[model samples]
Target: MERVPLSVLDLATVRAGHSSTDALLGTIAVARAADDLGYRRFWVAEHHNMPAVASTNPPVLIASVAAQTRTIRVGSGGVMLPNHMPFVVAEQFAMLEALHPGRIDLGIGRAPGTDQMTAAALRGVSPYLTVEQFPDHLRAVLALLGDDRIDAGPTARLRATPAPESFPEVWMLGSSTYGAQVAAALGLPFCYAYHFAMGSDVDRALELYRSGFQPSPRFPEPYPMVSASVIAAATTEEAIYLAGPSRVMVQSLRTGRLGPIVSPEEAADLDPELPGTQYAGTAEEVVAGLDDLIERTGARELMLAGTVYDPATRQDTLARIAKAWGM
Candidate 1:
């Protein structure tokens, strides 16, 4: 069988001793490495007021990464639909598609990527749609991007502006079943946040997505990608050691006190069991884990997400995994 394609989801993690500039540069470096290593997609996330994450605006980062890389697809891990108008998102992604042509993707999510107060600031009295209205907004974006199946209602008269000959591929991103249902009904590709939810509801979400999938012109069949936290090193012990910062970060998040990602040395004293189900081991061992994940979830693609503090180590891990996966 052909090897399953691998992708990456990077948060431009800011380390304890590194500046945000360093974090942004690290993202570019990783994207370059992924592109050179023959990865399929490289997605950046959007988070506001998070010291550890520097990928605040995806389009800007996508443009930068796309410009630097040669072949890997660049896109948002997600742009929270509730945080911006459909037209606004459509316009940004439309422009990206025009510039990058076939190398752009627009992944949409429902929840705001930040606190409610920050979300309010992002909406800025523009009559932001509630989370309940996300499906409607997603449809509107699709319509603006030329998905004629959508009625678009009042959004019909609007255009994303500077429309291109092609549109960016749209994917629904979620950690729960609602996103799965929406993506299936709309006939769009879906990416389950398996890493964020710690492997919860993944089987149910993917099952629903495939069973209820309705084909659309852009996406004729169900395409599901599972996001997983992974770390690959020369030895299982080394991989576990490298995962220290991620464990600490997860613990901090659980306590509602997110902070900059600390070095592994700094996180040595923290509890090591709070993080999600991450694949951390030698390349062959990690590949076995990924193979098991594929068998269990039946995902077409896997988006690897590792919160390692050092960019060089992160890039190295990707290379190791790619080699092991024969990509």
Candidate 2:
């Protein structure tokens, strides 16, 4: 019966400029506002080679966001594991845990996080998008965060220290059943990307997770995090008015246009099919759509990404959404 925690998923879009600094400042401001408004966490997504989003390195962005806000957890909705070495990720997150103390989390994904072109640039020739190496990679990351050894020979004795006896809370991020099984087998919290991988079968994926769960040191019981898209507006009409530009961007994404995000004025006039896809409407309705997701999925958290362009309007929508659930 606990009310859900309100969180942010920043895709690092600049509200009014075209520089990384613009994106950084906007992100910091969003985090600060969310913190002041009593939200729980502020997370950044990882999308390599995407011009619209500047937060490719979540730890670096998390540090920046944490520095600006006195409270509020900051983390990666996930760091794609297939593109990097597990030990290095553990080290990076360990450093974050050191800097932020109890506010860091390390959500991991098995995908390459990009198309074939960007994937090749980031990972060279390694093939991690396949299901075969995913479980091993997940275990490797956990082991590196613990007392376990990474290298096996006499010269391979590497230990990650200042481990807090526990590091950042690790969550498995996925859009399919494969992610559920891996999270269950490893006994970590699982988060579903119902936000982008929209479908009716996510329930089945959650089922696979709960049924196969086994307790580990990190979690004595299965913990789930459900992620969904939100575009909260004051009057349903006004919310739609403010959400226009982002809707066009979503349209561009689906049509392979990948153009610059259109202005809000342009978006407000477009039809639903032209906007590509979304979860729009008033805050009251968004909560209703998310209600059974929390209960049925056994989610310990809900990560809502408000995909709007204007920072002021976006923050306003977030606060009202939090109040919608009485948070």
Candidate 3:
């Protein structure tokens, strides 16, 4: 099988004993490690009003990561477009691309990155702020970035200022066929969120993306990527041990009790049988599992999202995965 590109999706999780500042620093360290290890991209996730997640503003975090890493691409694993204005999103990423040049990507998602209450607070009580409006919002963002004239009465010819020499590579992020269809129709790269929500029919979604894809000026062909949770260590026991915290953290989020991610020692008491999306084992085992996932999804790139509590452990896991993949 051909080797697939490896990337990272970091949420900047705040560990139990650490501050949000520590988590941000950890994100930079992880990005640097991933860059040195030959990872293709380091993408930060946008999560709002979540105590455990510190990456509320993806563009700012992407800028910081881009400044710290030289070779690896830096961008948002996804910036949830529903939470902010389309023009602002376009302008922020335009600035990032202006500073980082060819190393920036603009991955946009339709969902709100927070709870319903927080989402309402972020978007305000606007009747037009519905998921159905994502396509329009996305189009507006693209127009601003591409310097295309808009049809709005007052902002007809408005363009996002400080536009880079080149636009950041745009990607449509989704966990369902809706996103696939939109991305395909728009001819942008699509990223499937298998790490968080693995929809029942991922293959069908991919098929829809490929079948409906139309050649665009920016993207000539379909490019699909999948993000999955990975936890690999030198030993199977150690891998499982390190993954405990992530398991607990996921459960907390799912149960609507968002809090700081606990230490592995603290997580040991949680139910061992609680289901999780993570793949945890030795390097060889993890590689096999990830290979199977890639094969099943037909993804050209794999973005690993591991929420290990310790920064050092997280970096070590990424290094181990890189070595196993022979990157």
Off by over 4 Å in 2: 15-17, 128-132, 147-156, 161-166, 269-278
Put down candidate 2 lDDT per residue, 104-196, tens digits, no spaces.
889898887778777767767545453356677667777777724333233235544556645787888899998999888878888888787
Q: Which lDDT values do the candidates have, in the order given?
A: 0.91, 0.75, 0.86
What local lDDT does model 3 show for residue 31?
93
lDDT of 2 at 50: 64
Per lDDT, what order, best first?
1, 3, 2
For all predictions, the C-alpha RMSD in Å is: 1.5, 2.7, 1.8
User: What TM-score fits each model?
Assistant: 0.97, 0.90, 0.95
Q: Which candidate is the best by TM-score?
A: 1
**Better candidate number, 1 or 2, judged by lDDT:** 1
Best by lDDT: 1
Model 3: lDDT of residue 24: 98
Report the C-alpha lDDT of model 1 over 112-157, residue by residue, as the tens digit: 9888788888887432446777778888999999888899799888
